[model samples]
Target: MSKLALDAAVFSDAAVAPDTRLVNDAIVKALRALGERWAAPLPEIRAARLSGTGTFPLPPESPRARVETIPGPRGPVPVRILMPDGAPKGVYLHIHGGGWTVGSARENEGLTSRIAANCGLAVVSVDYALAPEEPYPAGPDDCEAAALWLVNEGPARFGTQRFAIGGESGGATLAAATLRRLRDRHGLSPFAAAVLTSGCFDLRLTPSVRNWGELPLVLNTEDIARFVGNYLRLEGRADDPDVSPLLASLKGMPRALFTVGTRDPLLDDTLFMANAWLAAGNATELDVYAGGCHVFIGFPGTITDQALKRIDAFLTGF
Candidate 1:
C-alpha cells in the first residue's frame, strides 16, 4: 500500500472547510466504538454496521413522489418514484449502495430527492434484495427488472425525454452492470448517461485491497472479502462482467461521471474504470475528492458538495 498518486487538495475546493481528515478520523472512531459495542450481538451487529452513522436528516414535510412496488421474478420489488411538480426533464433510476448485503430505499430517500430536485428529473430509487440471502444474480436481476420496467413503462407515465442510471458504492456497481445487461440482453438503450460514485467496479481483489490499512473510511479487508465471498458463489465468478463491469468491454456504453474520494479503498477502482472507459473511446469524466472516504456523496455539506455539483453538470449536459 503505497501513497495515493494525487494530492488531497485536488479533491476539495478552497472555499470548502479543511476538516476532512479530522472528520474522517471521528467517523472511524465512531465506527470502531460501534463495532466494539456490537461485538457480542452478531445478529444485531450486521444491521447496525450496515446502518451507517452520519445521515442527512430530511425535513418533516419534504415533498416526495409516490412509492410503488412492481412484481419481479422472485417477488415484489419496491421503488421510490420522485417526480417534479409538473413536467420532468428526464428520468433517473437510482440504486442505493449497501455492499450488496444491506441498505434500503428509505435509507437513500434524501439523496435521491436531492438529485431529482436539483436535476429536474424523475428519479426512481430501487430497493433491491441483499446478498447472502438473495445472492449474486438475484440483486442484479431485481435491478435489471426495475430498470427494464422503467424503460417500458416510464414514458407513458412520466412523459420524459430520456433515462439515466446512477448510484453510489454497491449501487453504482449495480447501475453499471444493469446498463450492460440492458444493452446486451434487452437491446434497450434507455440511459444516455451514468453517474458512478465510489463504485466498486472490480469484485476481484485489487492492489487497493492491500492498502486498506491506510484508508480509515472503508471497512476492513476481512469484511470486504466476506462481502465478495458471499456475493459470488463460484471461485472465478467474480471476474464475470456482470459482477465486475471493469472486466467488460466498455464500447458503446453511455457517457459517465466517475466520482471517488481519495481516502476510500475503492479510489483506485474508480480511477481504473474511468481510464478504461476513456481508453475504449467513451466519453467519461472523473472527479476525485481529496481526503474523502467511500460513498462520500451521501455525506452532504461535507466533502461531497463539489462532487455532486460535477454530477449535476454532467447529467444536465446529457
Candidate 2:
C-alpha cells in the first residue's frame, strides 16, 4: 500500500503526538497479513478479527466487576458493571465499539474499570445487539433501554441519579442516537456529559470518509462503507436523525467531548458534529490527535494516555 499523505492543514487542530502513527502503521501491517492468511470474506474476516475472541488478550478487568441484566425495549439487555473503591457519586453508561457487528461488554472492562475507579462512579457497559443479525434499530433500541433503565433504576441500585454516557466508533453513534431518543421521546436530557470517539455520526459518508482511499491507516473507505451497509441494511436511511446524529437537533443535549484522530476515516464526523453541537447551544469540546487512526485509544501510547486523561477530566468535572 501507498504511504498516507494529507494536507498539513488537515491536522491543524490535532495534538502533537509522536507514537500513534507508528503504532497504527504496525496495526495496518498486521491487518494486511491477517487478510492474506484468511480465505473468508471481508465481513467475516472483520467480524472474527473484532469478535473479542481473537488472539489478543485485552487489558484485565477490575476486581470489582459483575454482570447483570436489565429490562430493555426488546428484552433483557446484559450489562457489565464496575464499581469504584467506595460509594459512587454518579453512574456512567459505556457503549462498546465494533462497527455495530462485533464486540461485547466484557471486551472493554479494562477501560470501564479505569473510568469507574478514576471518576468515582459506577460504570455500566452495555452488550447491545449487532448488525447483519440484529441491525440498526436493535442496537439503538437496546442502548436506549439501557439508558432509560439507568435513569429510572440506577439511583435505587447505585445510590446516585447523576448519569453520563459515552462510546467509541459505532457505539458512539449509538450513544448519540440514544441521547436524542431520550430527549425527543421521553422529554429528558439527564446526562451530565458525553464522550464520542471516532464516531461515524453521518451515515452518508463525509468527504474524508468518502475520499480516504486504501491507505494502511487501520480503516479505508471500503471498510467504513461495508460497516454502514451492515448496520443500515438498506439505502435511503442515512438522513434520519436517529441514524445520523449530525442531522439531528442537538439542542438540550449534554455537554459533549468529540475526539478523533487526523488519520481516521471519520475525522470529518468529529469535526462536523462538534461544530453542530456547539452551534445548537450545547457545550462541546473537540480533540484531534495527529497521526492517530480509528479506535486509536485501544493502542497504548502517549496520545492514548493524554486522551484518557482528557476524558477523565471531562467526566470527573461533572
Candidate 3:
C-alpha cells in the first residue's frame, strides 16, 4: 500500500495499536508539561534551553559534520554542513525551527546529520537571525541569502546541482518564503523539492490556529500570535506575501511534501498550502499523521519512524 493508504489503515479505530495509544497518551502528558513550562518569560525559556533543562537527549553530532560561514544580507551566517560517507547525490538545505527565536544550526547537527546519511545528500542547515531583536526581514533575508548561495555554489561545493529545501514549524515557514523569494526576487527556480512539516503558512492566523485556543498540544493560539508578533514586530504585517507565503503566488514552485498531525494547530495551514501548491501547478504531497502533536517526528515511535522514512524517500528520490 502507499504511505497515505497505510496511514489510513494504521489510524483507523479498529486498527490502532496499543503501543500507538500509549505513545499518544505519553506525548499529550509531555506536551502539557512543556506548555506550562514554556509559558514562562521568553528569557526564562531561552535560559532553560541554554541550560539544557527539560530537553531530551539527542544523538552525538555526526563525525562528518562541520560548521562554515556563508555570506548573508546582514553579515556572515553560520551553517552546519553534514556529508554522507560517499559523494552526495544532491544537497538539502535545512532550516531549524524555534519560532523564529531560539534555535541554532550547531544544536540541530544531530538531526541534520541523520538526514545527510539517510538521504545521501549533504545537508546545509542555516542558522538564521532571530526575532524580537532582529525582527521582520532579518531571518527571511538570511535564509534567502543561504538559498541563493547554495544555488550558486552547491554544485562546486557538493559535486551535485540538484537541491531541496525544508524545515519544521517556523523554519518551514521561512523555507517556503525563501523559495518564493528565489523565484520572484532573484528570477531563480533552483530547488527540485521541498519538505514542510507543521508550518504556520498564514500568519494572519488560519482557522485551525485561531480556533486552537489555549489547548497547547505544543503551541497554543496565543503562543503563535505572540511569535508572529515578535517576528513581524508590527500590527498588521502578517498579511504581507513576503511574510506569509500562503498569501503569495506559488507559481513555478518546486514539488513539495507537507507533513502535519491531525492534532496540530497548523493542520489547516498545511491543508490550505498543499491545496494552493497543487492549484499553482506543482506536485504536492500532504501527509497527516493520526494522533500526532506538533514536531512529533523528533520523538521515538513507529509513527516518527514512518515519517522519517517517508522524508528520506522524498529527498533521496530527487
Top-scoring candidate (lDDT) = 2
Model 2 over residues 83-192: C-alpha lDDT tens digits? Answer: 98999988999999878876777778778888988989899999998887777788999999999999988889999888999999998999999999999999998898
lDDT of 3 by residue, 213-290 (tens): 877566779879888988988433988998899999999989899998776788889888888988888888878777
Which pairs of residues clash in candidate 1, taking residues 3 or more apart in a chain or in different chains?
Answer: 11-290
- Compared with the true structure, all predictions reach lDDT values of 0.77, 0.83, 0.83
Q: Give all candidate RMSDs, comma-separated.
A: 4.4, 5.0, 2.8
Clashing pairs in 3: none
Model 1, TM vs. native: 0.87
What would the TM-score be for candidate 2 when compared with the true structure? Answer: 0.90
lDDT of 3 at 311: 90
- Model 1 per-residue lDDT tens digits across residues 1-318: 111245556645452356776667776776665554324443354454335432223223237757789878799998888876558889998998878876766677767777777888888889898777678898899999999898888889788758889898889999999998998998877799998898889988666765686333656566667778767854338879989999998788888888887678887789899888887777787777777778876664466777777788777668
